[model samples]
Target: MPSSPNLYVYHRGEIIPLEKAFLHISDLAVQRGYGIFDFFKIINGIPLFLDDYLARFYESARLMHLPVLLTPDELKKVLYRLMAQNQIPQSGIKMVLTGGYSEDGYTPAAPNLLITQQPITLLTAAQVQQGIQVITYSYIRDLAEAKTINYSTGIRLQPHMRAQGAQDILYHQNGIITECPRSNLFIVTHDNQVITPKKDVLKGITRKNVLEVAHQKYATVEGVVTLTDLAQAKEAFTTSTTKQILPVVQVDDQVIGNGKPGTVTLDLWQDLLSLEKQQALVRV
Candidate 1:
């Protein structure tokens, strides 16, 4: 077990301890889930790809017409202060901006901001090392590209997946691969081509980096991949901020590349880990 991390929360225009921050009774985010958020991982005291995460957060807020009450720099200060308050060196931080209190009606209102940080356990490390099985379900969310607070559908699917001994669940709609419940899926062909679900999926930061790195070694890469295409692949993997590069040993009872993490996946994982270390050192 890991040590408990102190939590700092930013609410309204003030920074408060996580235990002290409170939401108003009429906040629409609590009532209707009208909010957007971004998750970031801090490595060696520096946030990995924070700029990209913030950009996405702003984009989500814009799409929902949520006003940007604070600039990015101001938000950065809050994040660092939260980290300091929490005594967090390496952790995961989530910043949530939600529709604030409103009258007795269903309508938009002023927005509220809250940021929280906690230690990241990365519980899937063992699963990554030994590789894990994956199951795909027909669960697709509207506005698949936006990062929002409503994750009930994805949250609801985890129990059913855990009952089957699967590490995660990938979502598909009409035979088209959308994304995994928490991560993005990838596959490598027998011919060394790397394939992933196209722009339809959440263009994950780790996913983007993996594709960029794999381009140097693989001859062909395609983003618009289907279930049929994935099943035919020689190897498969999932990417996320925490998971980094986790190979998929099976997909819905079918073994992927001898039911083990493949050589290409291992190689890419090593490269990504090295890159992370390098980035952390440079930032420090």
Candidate 2:
């Protein structure tokens, strides 16, 4: 969720005003940027991919050594309670687990948990047809698997990316493509193989489902994707919690697959949307 008028957040097991949901100044998340967060959308009061998101959330907590205050079931109850309080039918929820307040501001302690609901805009057909361009950067995240709070590199590169008229950053280390700032990168090869990076990347929930659907028709391969592969790719796309399945028509200055959304990309997008609708119905 981006922003919402709901104005309430679940902070430390209590539902309170968003403005009042503040941590101590000595919190490690504030001082040293120690935290992890996960975001998932709710369509018509039904949470999208709730199980997968929760699994990744707890995995991130485990990797970061942050003890979650509530169990998975307990957290779900809190989230639903928060949603009911907010009264926003279609929105997104963000769960943040921060390194606890530290007297020395360096050591980790009891973790702080927060949950907030906000709004999100889905991509329209027109926008989906047009697609987006991205600039490639040579870097990999420190803790690639964990959805940590450290986004200094990506955020700092935003200005440069926009300056080049690019919508996002496609990160690559050496010659191998890893992922984008907050999304997973996928490329359709000349041989029609759907390929995405297999290592040093966050296993995005959208990416997981994208592969699952892509496997139904295409030869999906979660293997190494290089810069050369992206350059000579037939089609490309990125997936995330927000940007579910967005076409990548251009990388840097090079146009991908005639500089428009490819058939395969669009097909996968429609299929993913259908899957979402089914998931929402099942949840309801």
Best by TM-score: 2
**How many clashes (backbone atoms < 3 Å, residues ≥3 apart in a chain or on different chains) does model 2 have?**
0
TM-score of each: 0.93, 0.97
By lDDT, who's the top model here? 2
Minimal lDDT window, size 10, model 2: 1-10
Extract clashing residue pairs from model 1: none
Candidate 2, 157-185: lDDT as tens digits:
98899899999999999989999989999
Q: Which portions of model 2 show Cα errors greater than 4 Å?
A: 1-6
Instruction: Report, for every candidate in turn, its global Cα lDDT versus the true structure.
Output: 0.81, 0.91
Candidate 1: residue 28 Cα off by (Å): 1.7
Candidate 1 Cα outliers beyond 4 Å, as residue runs: 1-6, 123-125, 220-222
Error of 1 at 264 (Å): 0.6
Report how far residue 284 has shifted in candidate 2, in Å: 5.9
